[model samples]
Target chain A: MKVRVGEIDLHVQRLSPDAERAPVVVLVHGMLYDSLASYYFTLGPAFAAAGLDVIMYDLRGHGRSSRPTTGYRLEEHIDDLVGLLDALEIDEPVHLVGNSYGGSIAFGLAAAQPERVASVVAIEAEPPVEAWSQRLGDGLARAKPWLITDEAIDLIKQAKGDHEARLSRGAGKLLQTTTIAEDVLLSRTIDPGLADIRCPVLALYGDESVLMEQVDYLKANLIGCRVVVLPEQGHSVLIERTAETSSLVLDWVREQSLVEAE
Target chain B: MSVDVQTTEAGVLEDLTGMLRVLLEEYGLEDAEITMATKFHEDLELESIDLVTLSGLLREHYGDRINFATFIADKELDEIIALTVGELVIFVVEALR
Candidate 1:
């Protein structure tokens, strides 16, 4: 469904239609080449089957949502998420699950409004830190070729066959026409620190993932946090290990709920 | 992928076929040519997102009455990618019945 949040239309998908009063678990997705489809295809139905009402949304300028030429910063994303929750009338403390960039948003929100978040599960995401500014800059430099180069854009447009042609055009619009590539390179200062996040947190990263140092930083900084390393998995662990990752999330949420009730 | 035809709904197949045609049109397939035997990935060349959309549409129209995800639930990613249109139709048919 199209959720209007601060002049932007966000695409929100619920796992079940009759989701009133169920344990709410909201999912946030990664930036660039990631959408609500990642969770919608893999973990969402699993969560719904486990009796949790799952919510996943496309970030600004991604998926079926409207691509505003700006607002790619973390603060805007936090506002977009909080506003969407308000629009949906979800007042209870809900579990927040995020992958890669989505994990960063989850971290920002939990730090900003710890009370609103029951627990946070970061899948291959790092908490917002001052040092991340440089990291994001370096990452953006590496990504510029595939994202902004005219040759890459031409190659994306040259998708063969009629079926792929449609996907190629849509992808080109997301990458070339929108300001996502440029907007994402600049991240606003995250107001709250990881020390400010008081909620229960579980961080997951592949043992082989390049972001191991970030995971170590998460363990050292965030209060009441536990980190897990998936064996033989990497940054794309969500796709490479869907069943195991979903199982981990399902079990984590259950344990967290039990502790909260007690 | 193995398609279980035991749950096929003879009554609803025609209406379901028509719906499939309209839905599959976005994938460059003609609605008139979509049949019970049409493959989702091979014939229609539908991507994972497309299957997700199809499932969402099925759930929207039929609600919880027809659990379409169960058809692809047990399958691995590759198996889901290989599923045919007939498999999906039968799953919906069985759920409705």
Candidate 2:
């Protein structure tokens, strides 16, 4: 469904359980060619079947959501989420499950409005620290040249096939046509120490992922946090390790709910 | 097969084909021929994201009778990727039974 949240219309899918007052679990996907489909095909249905109300939406400038040429900063994405929750009139605190860049947004919201988030499950993601911004800036800067070229797209098509080529083409358009590259760099960086987030957090990472380096920093900072590393995996843990990830998340969310009920 | 079952399956297949055509139009494949054996990923080139939209359309048409999410919940990703139109048609037909 198209939800009017502030300025843009977000494409949202809500899967409600048969039970009443089931805890809400919001699934946020990664950036650039990623959408709610990642969760919809894997974890969203599983979460719903386990009696949780699941909300999945495409972030602005991606998927079916309204894509303006500007306002692609991390804080703006956070505001969009806040507006979406408000528009839905959900008053209770909800669990946030975010992948990649989505995890950064989840941490940002938890930091900015600690009361709105009950718990967080970050899959191969980091908090939006200055270092995070710098990494993204450098990555996007490096890819911008090749991404915007037709030759590069053709090469991707030859190597990866049509679906991936289409995604690459879309990403190229998103990068070339919007302020996202610059705006995301300008996103307000949270404290590197992550002291403001009071909610319980479960961070999942692939043992082989470069982002694993942040695990120690996260453990040293957050008070109530747990980090799990999946063996023989990389950045694609969410898609590649769907079953295990789903089980771990369901267990984590259920445990948090038990704690809340206490 | 009973005459009644054949007729019912035919009706379900026709309806599902219409729904798929509507979805395929967005990808500029509106005029493409669809059949029971047409593979969603290989033949039509429909991405997993397109299935999300199809799920919504299924709910709108069949209400709660067809639980598209639950239907594919147990299937592995590879299985889902290899699904054919006939498989979905049978699932919908059985679901409405």
Candidate 3:
């Protein structure tokens, strides 16, 4: 289904019983993509079957939502998410899951509005802005230079193709500084400002992933973050290592339940 | 006799940077604009996050070819600035050899 958050329309996929007592899970996708037909095709149903109410939405300018040249800022995305929760009338804080860029947005929301979040499952995303930006810059320099192009929108639209094309699309988006709402969600200055965010955070990455080497640093720094590296996978752990990803998330939710029982 | 001195002093440095650039490009940073003087921080604008991410990418593609920790620590920005792409290539070739 689709919902209008503010000026723009958002594509939303909500799962679970209409019953109020059901646990809630919200899945947020990263930049230039939406939820319904994106990552949700795999990750969302798995979470829903794990006995939680699941919510997934396409960010503005993505999926079935209205596309504008601007307003793709992280704050705008967060506000849209808040608006969705409010409209749905979900009075309780919900479990949040985010992947890649979506992970950054999820962390931003949790840090800014701690009242709306219970726990977070961040996949292949880094903390705050400073580190992420520098990493982004480096990744751009190393991966593929030809990806930086003037026509980023067209490139992103063509992203769902084969490997080389997908890589180009992903690179095109990453290199375009203007299209990316740099400071809003994944800026260098935006600290996950909520000091009281003692909520459990599960940080997962692929074992062979270059980012895995630094997961230790993130775990050491973040207050209540735990790190797990999926063996033999790269950046797209959700797709490349789907079964393991599902099991890890399921085990985490179950573990949280046990902790609550105590 | 004096070959080792010339090779290590200038030849090795150039070769290393070239290889590093290729590695960086493979990870998606082809426009890195790297120079010998490009400090991972001040000059080239690389941070721990970049290094970490690059190391992760490297582990996947060039695992047998390089040692991330040692290579990362060894190449300071200024040390890298004087080298060219071709020289950098030779350095890596020697290292691999």
Error of 1 at B76 (Å): 3.0
- Residue pairs in clash, model 1: none
Model 2 residue A210 distance off true place after TM-score fit, in angstroms: 1.5
Better of 2 and 3 by DockQ: 2
| Model 2: CA > 4 A from native | A154-159, B1-7
**lDDT tens per residue, model 1, A221-250:** 775688889888879877778898899999
What fraction of the true Cα-Cα contacts (under 8 Å, chains A to B) does candidate 1 also have?
0.17
Give residue B10's error in model 3 in angstroms. Answer: 73
lDDT of 2 at B54: 85
Q: In order, what fnat does every candidate score?
A: 0.17, 0.48, 0.00
Q: TM-score ranking from best to worst? A: 2, 1, 3
Steric clash pairs (candidate 2): none
Per-residue alpha-carbon lDDT of model 3 for B47-95, expressed as tens digits? Answer: 3323434444444444446444344233432233232434333444565
TM-score, each model? 0.82, 0.93, 0.61
Kindly report which residue stretches of model 3 are placed more than 4 angstroms away from their true locations once superposed. Answer: A33-36, A137-145, A148-178, A181-188, A192-196, A257-262, B1-97
Task: Flag regions of model 1 displaced more than 4 Å.
Answer: A16-20, A145-172, A191-193, B1-45
Per-model C-alpha lDDT, please? 0.75, 0.89, 0.61
Top candidate, metric DockQ = 2
DockQ of 2: 0.54
Tens digits of per-residue lDDT for model 3 on A23-78?
67788776542234434445655666667788877777654566665665567777
TM-score of candidate 3 to 2 decimals = 0.61
**Higher TM-score: candidate 2 or 3?**
2
State the lDDT of candidate 2 residue by residue for A44-146, as single tens digits.
Answer: 9989989999999999998889999999999999999999999999879999999999999999999999888999999999999999999998888777778
